[model samples]
Target chain A: MTVNRQIHLVSRPQGEPSAANFKLVEAAVPALTEGQVLVRNHYLSLDPYMRGRMNEGKSYAAPQPLDAVMIGGTVGEVVDSKNDHFKVGDKVVGMGGWQEYQLVDANQRGVLQKVDTTHIPLSAYLGAVGMPGVTGWYGLVKIIDPKPGETVVVSAASGAVGGAVGQLAKARGARAVGLAGGPDKCRQVVEELGFDACIDYKQHPDVKSLSTALKEACPKGIDGYFENVGGIILDAVMLRANAFSRIAMCGMISGYNGEPIPMQYPQLILSNRMKIEGFIVSEHMEVWPEALKELGTLVATGKFKYRETVADGIASAPEAFLGLLKGKNFGKQLVKLI
Target chain B: MTVNRQIHLVSRPQGEPSAANFKLVEAAVPALTEGQVLVRNHYLSLDPYMRGRMNEGKSYAAPQPLDAVMIGGTVGEVVDSKNDHFKVGDKVVGMGGWQEYQLVDANQRGVLQKVDTTHIPLSAYLGAVGMPGVTGWYGLVKIIDPKPGETVVVSAASGAVGGAVGQLAKARGARAVGLAGGPDKCRQVVEELGFDACIDYKQHPDVKSLSTALKEACPKGIDGYFENVGGIILDAVMLRANAFSRIAMCGMISGYNGEPIPMQYPQLILSNRMKIEGFIVSEHMEVWPEALKELGTLVATGKFKYRETVADGIASAPEAFLGLLKGKNFGKQLVKLI
Candidate 1:
């Protein structure tokens, strides 16, 4: 029998999570059920949303109970299969939790096709080719529905979701502007992602200056605002949104770190005649096949690219997750297991 | 030449306007130029939005400059006509400012139809049958699209716009809840306006209690929200919005008194996967005829009713406007010159 080392939730976090919030424990792996497959986790995804799950509060998803295993998505290989769908040797991705080994239902796992790594790395599936990639694409194309000549602004532009959104907007012939925390990320967004302009939000002292820069970048004002960091940036953008502006509310990373909620700019909204919509990727699962197909082709042809900040070992997962919340991760933060 | 007495903006108000901010100036009426018709103001419309125009700040409309006649919509009689569209003795509605007499372009005025005041008061055209009526109708039918059996919440529910919105939503078979400032207004909303429930926000003390009461009254979560007051109340309603909920942003009377903008519950927006849209009635002018035709029929059938709080004399217009901002006006606030 194989043993599984799992990171369990030791306590709920009041604000920012720490190493003490998690406890690593080992347990003997149970025999797989008739419809289950044994998976050895290769890469664990560490995202900002996990922080919300760690806290005991009302949110979109259920909070992680104390002493329960910390939940996450994992890219793994099928070590042994008791189900006909997944064979031993098949690579898969599923909600495998923060564990070295997990016995998951065959229906829960998505089979990953072996592709030529020369064109794109396998880790691209976790970044540009994965959930974050689909999130940005769907949020911009489906929710925002930006016109060709319209200006599109995205927060966290160098990160996984924002970078993809900016690139996708560019691909659709929309003028793309990005807001990033640092100069290097801003430069990368403009140079690498081919955004029209990038705003270094960290260097900008106030939202007023950010608004001025944003207005200068897009003289026509923002037509589509893909919001990832919702706080002062959102307030500033709302002030300058053009008539019929569409705002896609994806994530609010700025507020997730336990800051006071920002003031509602209902006046700006009423005056501008804007539409602000919130969306979750899982809600559009029916059309995801088509989206994934398009995204997969883009990555295969080198049209779309991504970056990964992979932390070594399961012990570093919490640190990586905290770093992602702090914007330390250049792209998608992942923990690799040997 | 008929001399016109105009209320001019002496100075912009810092927070709320007092009698000192306005100056009643009697000036000699200018000779009617080509294409200009001389008009005698009969009834002036006093609205809360006029408060924004009084200030020297960026808004949907240009600010009222110092010493300039305070801007407003008015029902006037054309004393002399230079343009072919209007003739002497024809009653019309135009942007005539707060004045006794003025020179206007014939192209700028809408010809008011002479109707029987016995059935429906002529002032109803300026109140429920005019801009406020269209504002509520369009915002409800087009923007919010309140579904049958769905719960709808309207802020400032006893006022001109909110009252009309609640009535329209009720007409559409939606469960309507009204949020008003006083117990009298709340009673009027439920009994007269036919709202399913009413919340007297003044007595509630805290928005959380109101929210709980609103949820208890709604049972089924709110699907549409017609917002006129944007403060903590909006934040509270946002928290109870269900998936695919639509918020039609009408006005923000709560913040109009120069109160600091209230904190937003943007996280609730994402969690609920909601949509909030802001619209101006002017943008939907093409569809106005359809809405007006329906509203006219409703008025004629006595299915939809309106109440006007007429503050007699042009001098009382500023006080009426101040009363509107303070939620003292039970229904549509109007200034009668006759």
Candidate 2:
């Protein structure tokens, strides 16, 4: 019998999560039933969204259960199966949680989707061609709906979702501007990600200073914005937005740790006549096939270039997740449990 | 020749507009050339949007120019016409400003349009069948787009746009709820305007109390909110909003006069997955014909009822407008000039 190592949420954090909040454990893999599949998870995605799930307060999602396997997205190959669909050595993507192995009921349709890892890497399914990529596609195509020659701005430009948003906007013929925390991330956003311009937000402290930088970068004013980090960045976007702009509110990672992030200039929404919409990517399942097709083509053809930071094992997930919240991880933060 | 008595913006208001900000002056009506028409203004509309025009700050529209005739909507009779489309005794509505007589060059296509007041009264054209009515229609229909059986709420519920919004939502088979300033207005909203429920916002001091009242009134939670008053009312609506609720941000009248109205809980937008869009009514001319047809039919058939608080003469416009800002004037505030 295989011993499956896993991470569990030991406790909920008040402000910021630490190592004390997670516990690593080992459990023997249960024998697969007639319609069951055993997936040995290769890569586990550590996302900013996981932080919101850690808080006990009423949030976008239900709080991550204490003393349980930390809910997560995983891409791996099936090591054992007693099911008709999933066979041994078949690669698949599923919500395998923070564990070395997942016992999935293959009878469930959407629970497991077999992915072809010939041209695309197995880890890419957890980044560019997966949930994060689909999020970017939805915000750009459905919400922002940028036209050719329009200026599109995105926060957290080095991150998986933000990078995809900027690149996709560029593909639509819009001038894509990215806001990244450090000079290194800004370099990656501009040179690596193919954005028209990348603003190093670390140079500016407040809304006024950042707005000046944004104004220089987007002389015609911003037509669309895909927001990841809120607070000062959102305020700057509001100040510099063109009339009739659209803002896709994705995440407020800056204030996710029990901080009050009030929108300072909501009147600008009226003055600029903006459409600000917040959405969950999972709720919009209809667009996944199309978004994935586009994203898959982009990655397979080498049009979509992404960076990844991989931690060693399932035990490293907590530290890696904390780093993601602090903008420490350069790109898509993942735990390589293989 | 007729003497045109006009009110000019003598000075911009610091907090609120007082009599000192406006100057009542008389000028000789300009002589008409070919394709020119002289309109003897009957009713000068005193709307909340006009208050926004009184400020010198960079706002939705261009700042109401210093020492110029105050911009307004007017419904009146044509005394003389040199145009092919118009004749003497034609009832028309146009941007006539704060003046008794207007010399309009009829060649300007959209500056003037004739209205039939056979069943619908001339003053009704300024309220229920005019810009205010269309403002409600566009916000509710285009932005909110409330589904049947869903609960739709409107702030400033006794006012022109708010009243129309509630009635229109009801027309679409949705439960219409309202937030008015006082007991009298709340009573009018429920009894006269036919809202499902009405909450007297004056009874509640802050967001918590108002939100409690809103929760009780909308037990099913708010599916859509048409915001006219901002600050406390907007905060209350945000607290009581359901998942995937849509907020049509029409006006922030409460904070129009240089007060900061920051959004308190933008996190709720992400949690609730809300869509908040701000718009100016005039910018959407395509929906005017459809909106007017619906409103006109409702008013003509006696299915829709409206109240008017008319201040006598063009000189009364400034005080009437100031009263509107304070929520003192009920229903469609107008200045009757004959």
Candidate 3:
């Protein structure tokens, strides 16, 4: 129990990540300091953003250093606390990385916060009501700002952030359309997530084909678009976008592996007079409280639905993360440690 | 004179327009009726926007109808009037098209407007205090909206709209950078237009080379961009754009001839978190009054400088317009009708 198992990034991947890029190591957990708290991580979040951190390229965030525990979001229980804020057995959320345990400086701001899991599940604190949820909220509410009866489209509709975007749009009385990978995920997006329509993107691989499906799903044309996957999905959406459409650029997971995905018709941006903006959610901390409160209430009351794909242990994190990048995960990919 | 010599669009061009596309025709002047005002146009504005109308393709404005006098902005003196608002010899600005004379229904809104020409010259009404100036005002003040000390970049800096963009950015306390075609134009952009720095894009044909020049010119990176010429210029500007930069998509003349000028690195929009919005100045009529007032004052006081390349007569309009599209025009291209 004193030994902590962690996965460290050994080498950066050229294109797609592989097993050899990561290494497993065991180290003894050090005793807690005067202001430090010891936490045993129960679940680790695996996101497509992790793929970006693995590269040495300049991005919104710094690259994850080699031979360091992979950077991630985690939910855990505080076993020992030196600070009054976090008590023992309190479930908290923090950037605990891909490790079995975490030693957090309790005095540090934004390091750790106790979450109420009385209604919402503990693992869900790392999913909804967390970073991903807030990301979706900011992109939709701030950038998109879709009007009632406007049609809003989101790529990767089965994922955590995309699901939240569709639900938020629906709540605002806008038509929420989705684009997902396979037939199964597409079905879940419309049936479970309650999106008005979901198109199976795999069935329509090219821009023209996908655009045809999008037009059918959204008869009035796309008024707002939440972009998670770039390339053909973005190209297709641009074709169907209405005049004065708003496109909130979130993640470009489709181009994360380093292929150049150019906009085939950027001139449409000028012709249609659209507004496209990209944003990083962490840069906007002001919206977190409001976004989390609404997300937590909806999730707790079952008004908002979400799914999880949990891999058993920390050793399975790298594979789970790779699966997430490949769209193998049906929903929020999480690594269960406890 | 009872005859009106007018240039008409006889045929739409396949790619670049030539003399064969236009025809000179003569028509008898009609007798004045109720609410009618007849004007002898002195100057016809030969703007790049007219080139867009020559194509049958969809654009911000309607296509130039074949066998009709070409649509344009003109400043002239009223020869006769039946309306109480306008009198003979009154200097005015209106959409008089490419003709020696115009019969305007003064009762209709936005048709005929009386001008003082006390401080501002009659010809200046078509260039600095007209649509081109308002176009620049909308992009710089309304769209780009640069804060003090931020850097702004405008391409085709010697052109009327581009010249105004750089000047407005300077007025707002922003560092104005420019990208012009040749050395002569580049020199005028910095020396006459007062841009902080100007890069001659002709020296650097490729994105990498142009981006290198842009880096030297804009040390802090581009904070706001006014796009006039798209394709490589836009691609080069995208490379140097700072995070959260605002790009006003005013024109894409480089691709106006019907070619796929794809944005080579669309992912950069996401990585840099930029806002790219397209707008047509005509669509926003609300800003015209305030824009024209400031523009009229600036030009009248000689604080604002402009150059015009005037063709001998309306018969030379077709060749002069073709030259403007090929970057041969020194500044604002105009046709002398009287």
Candidate 4:
């Protein structure tokens, strides 16, 4: 019988999670029931939203139960299967938790076809060509519905979701502007992603000045805003929103750790007739296939690109998650298992 | 030659406007040019929006210039006509300002048909059937779109716009709740305007308690919010909004005086996925006829009712306006001049 090494929730986090909050333990692998497939994790995705799940609070999703295995999405290979749909050596993606081995229902897991590494890296499924890619696609196409001449701005521009948003918006013939933490990421976003402009928030400390810079980049004012980092950046972009502006709020990474900043100029919302909508990616799971298909095509054409900060083992997952919160991850953060 | 009695803007107010801000002067009325019609003022519509016009600050409309006639909409009778469409004794509505006599372009003014006073008073056009009525109607029907099972809440529910909003929302089959300053106005809102409930802010010092009361009245949570007085009331309502709630931001009368009380809850917006949209009734004037037709039918059927605080003569307009700021008016505040 195969033994599974799992990281379970040791304790709930107060503000930012630390390694102590997680405990690694070896447990006996359960027998595969009917319609279940055993998975050996190849790569586990570490996301910023996991920080929210670590805390015991009400959110779009329920908080991870105390003492339960740490919840996460994973790319794995089917080692054994009782289900007809999944066979041995089948590559799959599912909520496999922070575990070396997991038994998931075949219907609950997605069978990802083995992609040619020469064409596109297998890790793209965890980053640019995966959930993050689909998140950006759904927001840009479905929520924002940006027109050809309109200007679109996205925060966390070099990160997985924001990078995809910037490229997709550009693909739609809309002018794309990005806001990143540092100069290097900003340059990478503009030069590599083909965004019209990028604002480095670290160099431009004044929010109003950054807003003016963004306005200069987008002379007509922002028509669509794909918000990932929310805080002063959100406050800045809000000032430059034109009438009938659509703000697709995907995540509020900036304010997740701290107390929320009081909105300074909400009257702008009244004056500009702006529409801000917040949504979790899972809420649009049914329409995810459409987003994935489009994203897959873009990736296959080499028009879309993504970076990953992959940790060596499951023990490094917490550090990778912490790095994501600190804006240290260039794109998607992932934990690789041996 | 007709002499015109004009009220000029003397000084901009620091806070609540006093008599010192206005100066009344008499001037010989100019001869009507081509397309100009000589108007003798009859009824002047005093509204809260006029307060914004007095301040030398940014708003939807340009602020009144120093020493210029205080701008206002007036129901008047055409004394002399130099235009083809208008004739002597023709009742019309135009931007006549605060004056006894004025000359306006006939094309710039709308002809006001003299309706049966027995059916509804002529001044009802200034209140329930005019700008205020249209403001409430458009905000509720177009912006809020309250469903039958939805809960609708309006601030300043005893005032012109708010009273109309509560009544219209009730007619549209939504549970209506109002927030007013005093207990008397709160009682009047529930008893007269037929609101499901009314919260007296003065009596309920704790905003959270007031919110709880509003929540109890609206068990399903607020689906549509018709905001007139912004600030703490808005803060309370924002907390109670369910997912996909719509806020029709009409006026922020609470913050009209100067800087508002600093708001402490913007995270509620991201959490609830609420939408706050600001609109001016004038923006959707094309749909005015349809709104008026619906509102008129409601009034005719005795299903909708309106109350007006009529201040006799033009001199009382300032005091009435100040009273409106203090929530002294039971409904629409008007100045009747003969």
Worst 10 residues of 4 chain B by lDDT: B108-117
Point out where model 1 deviates above 4 Å. A107-121, A208-220, A264-266, B27-40, B76-84, B87-91, B107-120, B212-216
DockQ for model 4 equals 0.52
What does candidate 2 score on TM? 0.99
Off by over 4 Å in 2: none
lDDT by residue for model 3 (B59-143), tens: 7678999999999999999999999999999999999999999999999998988898889888878888988899999999998
Best by DockQ: 3
Q: How accurately is candidate 3 docked according to DockQ? A: 0.87
lDDT of 2 by residue, B140-195 (tens): 99999999999999999999999999999999999999998889999999999999
lDDT of 4: 0.81
Q: What is the DockQ of each candidate?
A: 0.59, 0.81, 0.87, 0.52
Error of 2 at A272 (Å): 0.8
**Where does candidate 4 stray beyond 4 Å?**
A108-121, A206-209, B108-118, B260-262
- Greater-TM-score candidate between 1 and 3: 3
RMSD of 1: 3.0
Chain A vs. true chain A, TM-score per model, equals: 0.94, 0.99, 0.99, 0.94
Summing lDDT over every window of 10 consecutive residues in candidate 2 chain B, give the lowest-scoring window.
Answer: B52-61
Lowest lDDT block of 10, candidate 4 chain A: A108-117
Task: Say which prediction, candidate 1 or candidate 3, comes out ahead on lDDT.
Answer: 3
Tens digits of per-residue lDDT for model 3, A1-338:
49999999999998989989999999899988889999999999998888999999788789999999999999999999898888899999999999999999989999998988899998888777788888889999999998999999999899988999999999999999998989999999999999999999999978899989988999999999999999999999999989999999999997999999999999889889999999889899998999999999899899998999999999999888888888999888899999
Ranking by lDDT: 2, 3, 1, 4
Interface RMSD for each of the candidates? 1.6, 1.0, 0.9, 2.1
Ranking according to TM-score, highest score first: 2, 3, 4, 1
- Interface DockQ of candidate 1: 0.59
